[model samples]
Target: MLAVPLLGLINQYLGFLAMIAAIVLVWKDSPWQKGAKVAATIAAMALLGAVLPDPPEEGAAGVARKDRKAAAARTLTSPSPSAAQDDPSPTTEPRPEAADYRGMRLDEARDKAEAAGFGTSDHNASDDDKNIWMRSNWTVCFQKSSWTGSETKTIDFGAVQTGAPCPSTDGGAIPWPTMPELTWKTWKTARNEVVALGVVPTEHLRADTAYLNDTLPDEGKYDNWRVCATDPLEGADVTINTWVTLELTHPDNGCPDPSQSKEDRVDLPDRDDDGDPDYHDPFPGDRNRNSVFPNGLPDSSGNSSGGDGSDGDSWNCPRTRWC
Candidate 1:
């Protein structure tokens, strides 16, 4: 009586017609014959119905609608490239090509220096280390603004102790000292003196001091020796700020007066010598001593002010020591 086998034997349209015929035949025949015929017809119809392919259910209808909608959406949407072109708001602007500074990072202001054709040197090797020399004798100091951007700042190159051989790596290496060596006394006393002289502002002097203290010598043998300059000596009385001398030396070497004379080398104090302290002018030219030599101590020159003097008035103390 199952419809499945009968449906398979008959075509789908014929199966439908046979089911209707069986219903009608059951209604018209005599009781016994009718019952027999009806039963047989019903069995055939059931078999056909079972074997026929099922009509789509509600779930299937929903699936078909979703597929059609997805296709329509694809057709309605513009091509990716064309959509991007048509958009008025740009994702990014056309920026000026970033300049290269010989592996040095670039900043906006320092870009000018790179355009002027100057090379930069890396002075930072460690995270805790400070790179004071980056401001020395270079046209510009650049800082990485973001992962991809840079900005330029002006550096006081004239303050750099040029000609001083870079610090040695190993111990027992003879320290080939630089000229116009800055004693510990000079470094300690000079920062305030420069501000008093009106050459740099209090903030700038503090920044300079912080820079010296933070940046350690490559050898690490001398903790106190730092970058110092003699050119445009802190309190020199010159029409042009020449006669500048910049150097690196130990705090002991910076003492105004060593207990032993230059002839007999004396062991300078690491800390401030409380007794019989050697008093020396932090500034060069012995301005405190009244020793006036015509080209002032052999380091005198016309262009001694290392930085552009145009903005000397604005040289105030820096807000922060680090960039």
Candidate 2:
């Protein structure tokens, strides 16, 4: 009986056994006196109450603990509001707005379109699908663009050279400028004819002559040579991108037999008093001896027509005889 109350201090299970033993000793017969048994029963009951865990109470502190646990559980299970906003679903970008590009310079139109997030491509407005090499020299005649709101699109521009007029409509065969009759014409005249129409022909040396490429003094001076034949021939349709080749030879060599037909012969004007025509004379002014007597002057030194008077050289002679 004495040991029962002491054992109850260790754990609830031991305390429960002590309590039961004390109760039996008090109610049923015992070797100890009644007073002793009663005392032992009270001690066992107090110790059991101290050792055992307490049942939950409906109080303010208990409610606060419960609320804290619920908050912790929610933090573990749910995502933050900021996190949800940051990770939104994917979406397509909107298409750029359209605008009329007619009459604008091709280069300017390209810049404007690119700024608006649109890709650009351009073609000659004429019948030929010519490449737009010099954008500044061309003006937009028409534009074609199509796209859904969810997709991107490229703007196709139809253009002509800056000074020319635009076509009546878009997206069809554009009529090119007519190629002029360039056969037997001076290189300068032939070149000007095409350049006025915004085309530059490629010059090729057709005849075997001393003059070579553009490095020579006569390279860019177009009057020094004449066109033998043109690649596309005369009256053919041509565009800025057309492959034009002017087969050329020095004026002294003359054109080849094939291109020298009477119908193709061009009468070159004599711009200066020199007997030689403007195309044949390198120095058209009468100051040069070669220009004064274009045929040949009698040589004082030899039987030859002129002593060392090559095609372009000036001869020093006494002007009194032929004066």
Model 2 worst lDDT window (10 residues)? 207-216
- List the pairs of residues colliding in candidate 2: 126-174, 127-174, 127-175
List per-prediction Cα lDDT, in the order shown: 0.39, 0.65
Q: List all candidate RMSDs to the true structure.
A: 23.5, 17.1
Best by lDDT: 2
lDDT of 1: 0.39
Report the CA-based lDDT of candidate 2 relative to the real structure.
0.65
* TM-score, one value per model: 0.22, 0.34
Residue by residue across 57-90, what tens digits does model 2's lDDT show? 6697789898999999999888799888988878
Stretches > 4 Å off in candidate 2:
1-100, 105-107, 110-139, 144-167, 201-217, 220-224, 249-254, 259-323
